[model samples]
Target chain A: DVKVTQSSRYLVKRTGEKVFLECVQDMDHENMFWYRQDPGLGLRLIYFSYDVKMKEKGDIPEGYSVSREKKERFSLILESASTNQTSMYLCASSPSKSTEAFFGQGTRLTVV
Target chain B: DQQVKQNSPSLSVQEGRISILNCDYTNSMFDYFLWYKKYPAEGPTFLISISSIKDKNEDGRFTVFLNKSAKHLSLHIVPSQPGDSAVYFCAAIGNTGFQKLVFGTGTRLLVSP
Candidate 1:
């Protein structure tokens, strides 16, 4: 079965603290993405990696950064957690030739 | 500006009724469109997709229609059930040779039994 796994399901962090969210995929997909879903904002892309060590900014990448050191693993970093950053973070992966992307279960992060 | 837009914020429907969700896009470079279903606290799942070459694509219970001229697409759910209640997102991918997706603000669907 194709699976995208997130390191944490929920996390609560203090303001100004640095946060890291990890994601891994079993499928050998070349493209990985990070997105945050809000009530009315839907899923806004934060960062995406097309290949190892290759990263690009999405629609929103102000306070977020991403790392793709390996083929299957991608990480999202928050420089300083804030209350507005509290939202459901989703990780998705897709093959370079395919448009269908598979997503992880998601991590609900709360910044206090 | 949002490349893709789902103007409706919410929709309610009775069980066994048909539910239609609309989406519009402004970018003409988008050659593929997709619909994703999301539940509270869970990640959005791929529901259906349509290519620019075709106007319609159908799965078991979901059908997606694309209108290239209008830069619009829609998802139709037949006999919607309570289980179908969730947030529906419309997404698009340009012909940029990569799978970078652009999504619109979602439409919350409520199917009451």
Candidate 2:
């Protein structure tokens, strides 16, 4: 079975603070993604990495950045955390061009 | 605009009955469709999938049917059990290789005994 683990399950940060969410996958998948899920808005992609050091902006990449220094780890960074940035962040990984994606438990971030 | 839509926000079904969840997509370029079930406080799990090349795919009691002409897909769960209750999300990926998926808002399913 594939396992995707996140660094934190819940986090709280003050406004204007920097935040980092980490994800690691044991499947050695080539594609990893970051998504923020909101009620009524669904899961919107924030960023994705196809390979080490290669990243692409998804539909909603603003206020967020990602790092993929290694194949097994992906990190999402918030330059300046704001109240509006509070959301349930999910990390997923899949084989290149494959439809099956395994997701982590998700991190619920709260910005106050 | 929302490319994928799950019109029904919630559905109720009795145990041992069939629960059908529907999803629609506006993008005709999407060739792959997938259904995911998510329990509260947990990440969504891959339930089943159907490629455009096939009209129907079945896995045990869960089956997915696709209608290319209408760009509609449905997930049917037979003999619904309490464990089947969860939020079902329909997702699609375009023909573009390694493209990101467009997900529906999701439908909450409740199974009663």
Candidate 3:
């Protein structure tokens, strides 16, 4: 089975603090993605990496950034946590664009 | 604007009834469409998918129907069970090969016994 793991399931931080949410996939997939899911808004893509060190901005990438240094790991970074940025973050990996993706359990972030 | 849209925000069905969830897309370039189911505090899981060329695809109790001309799709669940309650997201992808998927707002389905 394919597994995508998020380092933290829940996080709390003060506003203006820098936050790092880690994700790792064991499937050795070529594509990795970070998405933020909000109530009613559904899943909004933040960033996606097609290859090692290659990244593209998704629909919503304003307050966030991502890093894909290696094939099996992709990380999402919040430069400065804001109250409005509080939401559930999900990580996913897929073999290619046409294939189904495997997702991590997700990390709920709270900014105060 | 949302390229993919799920008009119904929520739907309720009794167990053993048929649950129909609808989705529409504005982009004509999309060649692949997929459905995902998500539970509270958990990430969205891939449920079923249908290619643009095919009209219907089935996997056990879950079936996906696609109409290329209307750019519409629907997911039908037969004999709905309590375990079927979750948020269903419809996503569309064009073969840009970059893997950028346009997703709908999602519809929450609740099955009651």
Q: Candidate 1, TM-score vs. the true structure?
A: 0.98
Instruction: Residues B1-113, candidate 3: write the lDDT tens digits.
Output: 88899999999999999999999999888999999999998888999999998999999999999999998999999989999999999998887766676789999999999
Candidate 3: regions farther than 4 A off? none
- Candidate 3 residue A21 Cα shift, in angstroms, is 0.4
TM-score of each: 0.98, 0.98, 0.98
Tell me what fraction of the real C-alpha contacts between chains A and B each candidate also makes.
0.82, 0.66, 0.68
* Alpha-carbon runs more than 4 Å astray in model 1: none
Write candidate 1's Cα lDDT for B1-113 as tens digits: 88999999999999999999999999999999999999987888999999999999999989999999999999999989999999999999999888888999999999999
**How does each model score on lDDT?**
0.95, 0.94, 0.92
Cα lDDT tens digits, model 1, A44-104, are 9999999999999998999998899999999999999999999999999999899999999
lDDT at residue B48 of model 1 (Cα atoms)? 95
Off by over 4 Å in 2: none
Score candidate 1 by DockQ. 0.85
Q: Give candidate 2's iRMS in Å, 1 decimal.
A: 1.1
Residue A88 of model 2: what lDDT?
Answer: 94
- Index of the highest-DockQ prediction: 1
lDDT of 3 by residue, A9-82 (tens): 99999999999999999988999999999888888899999999999999899999999999999999999999
Q: Give candidate 2's error at residue A79 in angstroms.
A: 0.8
Cα shift from native, residue B18, model 2 (Å): 0.9
